[model samples]
Target: MVGSFSDIGATSTDFCNFRRDLLAYISGADAQMVVEDMYKNKEMEPDFYFDFDLNEDRELCRFFWADTISRKNYVCFGDVMSFDATYSTNRYKLIFVPFTGVDNHKQSITFGAGLIAREDVESYEWLLKNFKTAMGYTPRCVITDQDPALKVAIPNIMPETRHRFCMWHIMEKVGDKVGNALAQNMEFRKALNNAVWDETLSVTTFELKWAKVMQEYNLVQHRWFDQMYKARASWIPAYFQDIFMGGLLKTTSRSESENSYFGKFTNHHNSLVEFIMQYNRAIGEQRYHQKQLDAKGESSFPETKTPLAIERQAAAMYTKNIFYDFQEEIWEGNFTCKITCKTNDDGGYKYTVHETGGNIFENEGVEEIPGCYIVPRWTKSACAQPMYNVVWKACSNTQGGNELRTIANQLWNEFYNCMGLANGCPTEMDIMLSTMQELKGRLQSARQQTRASTTPQSVIESILNATAPAEIQIKPPSVAKNKGSGKRLKSNKEKATEKGKKKVRTCATCDRPGHDSRNCPERKALPDE
Candidate 1:
């Protein structure tokens, strides 16, 4: 029953109370003896034995002891270093997390320190120094956000080691700045994505292509590109290129994925120590899973597949031919034809053609002609040309002359009009004259009908004539003056009172009624308290 209390609901507080009660029960001289007996009995219990050493083989024992003893001593020997910083909720925190790369399967965190000021150079240097002390040696590589502080501090502290920017952090920044439009423009997006794999092209070429992509999507130029370019040499892990870094010299998405795991435990915990413990436990579980995965021979990760090479090959083959075909369609016409071919310096061919006396009246390349142009019968006959015209003459009713030619000419003109081209059709003036003559005949018929239907009547004589131009009548000067004087008096009154008077406050000092605060010297004096 006494041991059951320790087993069932044991806590530090509970254990402290238990210790006090046991001490009081045993009393003064027997307390130490009773404690030793209790400890030895608890140690002998199978449950306690199993809890401490259940899977403790000689190898496991050696590893456990070595890790335990070395970690304390190794506190001064830095081995694994991680440089990570985050800015959220308007506060910046950097963490130099130290770990021991004990086995391929395990990394034991030796020590970690949180930095309040990420941007300060001294703060980052302090973190690196702490990391160096926590692990057994200087870190081989420091992974961090692409922070300027880390760039400076990492090199200064561990000059021989590598510094890497986190790929996930950069991508997040790209999303925030460039936005979904980068994804919307598929070609530009592919170009940007492909930039990582383009080793044949120099970094400068990649940068230029990147700029072109940003321009295509109308994204503002960002500092991230400069950061990426600067960190290209070190951040790309040589051995882990394809396996971990996606074959690019950029940060991995692992940090972000880890951060997300941490986010789940963030609720209602105000203690930093609690947060760290929970985070470490989570990390342990993740390591366990990763170890299982590794045991299954699946530790190596696959690189992201970039289709840039295939796309470039396809584009190179098709682009020029497609452009030529489009231009040929625009130039298609029928005529007496002349074709000219020229060879470019690059071994490519350019073709030009001129077509005369046909509906299709231009030249085209061999590639440009439509399938209809190759019809055997149409090719043989000159009249079958796209723009062929037939001449026609007017024929009397008694004898129809050249009716076929007239029909052909009308059809040709109609086709020309449909094509929005002037191929020698009659002018608008001719159309207008013919329309007016037809209208004149209709007008004459209407006039004859009106004449037949109506009768006119007139008066016989006028008895008296009216006189011309009566003498000019004008108002007397006195009446005009009286009329004008009334308006003048009103105008004079309006002029005298143009705008209403503004109320003016009297100045206290000057004792003048028209002035306000600006002219009041009394207002400028200091008031007595």
Candidate 2:
């Protein structure tokens, strides 16, 4: 027989009893009812807006929240957002949807939150619409996992917004989707990585590398590759690297982390009231941390790398965290990089930036591949002189070939322009042009000096490899629009091939040939054993 609560606390069965009590409380309570009460309470508070949906049976289907602070943060830092519906919280199995943004301290801040009963398009649409309604503005860019429903809903709701698929999520799936043979192939992996991650490569360069990789691996017919290629613009950074994303998030990783952070306070076993209370506590702590960062940002000044006006300006303008990042760029731009004219005549100069730090590729414990592969020098062509506004082509590929292509473009104005060309010097326009001409002259002199010694046998080989075309010109495809037809009708052979190809599901847990890990029978015994 169990005694009073005080006596139970001293016993060995305390934890078990506590868990049992929590379970009992959760089972007895109505989650929807508790949430409704919370809604009513928050309604009384200033600037706290929440909405919910119910099914025909009056069951809670969805819930959304945006408090006073959340709305304020959204207005300031709402330009970029990372929305994810991956986490399932509460015993009710509600899909936790969070619209997260970056704050001043570079911390993940929740702009709004939603809970949905289903992962369908309708549920997502409702959630997104509610978020839009509450915030009164659409985010410029939205990053999320590659969910079909979300892919549909985002554009429907916020048509102007750039919807980016999380590169991290796409890259994470690569190892599992590609077989061991391809995964083990070092050259293939490198090519694939370059194809996916190298934003520095122009579209032409990417196409070249991609074709080479796919042909070598015979992966042109692969379903995953086909789907990913078709959806390249959604996930690939090379497609839209120019857009500003508030540096908040490039992936849904922050949202995932926020989910885990919220998990520390509440559990699935928690009662509705308990869950709400814990959620408030978690949110309170998060906001408090933000406030602390705000105070720190406002009160302090960061030390500059050099006594440049731009560096000082950045230090004064941006918050501490962002200023540090700017400072890093300042230092890197000034010391580690150099500009040389690749080609220059009358029709503007083509300058290539030479950087000491190139792309570094390594396989950690994979002995089959080399320990390290370092691309010591990578170059980007800058079209036109600095005075006339420089347009830099994609730099050489990144060291760690991940899918996010970072294109560093500096516009002609303020410190940004200064750092790129003059190393933070406020020079007159004529002087800058003269400096460019002198640099071009120097490059021509250097190239002439190094041409004979540097022109390897490979250049001669490449020249020999180019076969002169015979007097034959293939007829181009018909450009005239066929009446009553916008679609290209596929032949029977293509249809048959499509029908023959069946998509396979691999078990993540057991690594089995068939079946998903979620439905794997081996999961139960496999974990313990």
The 0-to-1 C-alpha lDDT of every candidate, in the order given, reads 0.41, 0.66
lDDT string, candidate 2, 30-84, tens digits: 4444555555556454467788766665556678888777777776667788977
Clash pairs for candidate 2: 197-402, 197-403, 359-399, 360-399
lDDT of 1 by residue, 310-376 (tens): 3232222322323233334343432245554544535655555545643232322244234543321
Give TM-scores for every candidate, taking all chains together and pairing residue i with residue i.
0.33, 0.59
Top TM-score prediction, candidate number: 2
Worst 10 residues of 2 by lDDT: 375-384
lDDT of 2 at 20: 62
> Candidate 1: deviation at residue 219, Å?
8.5
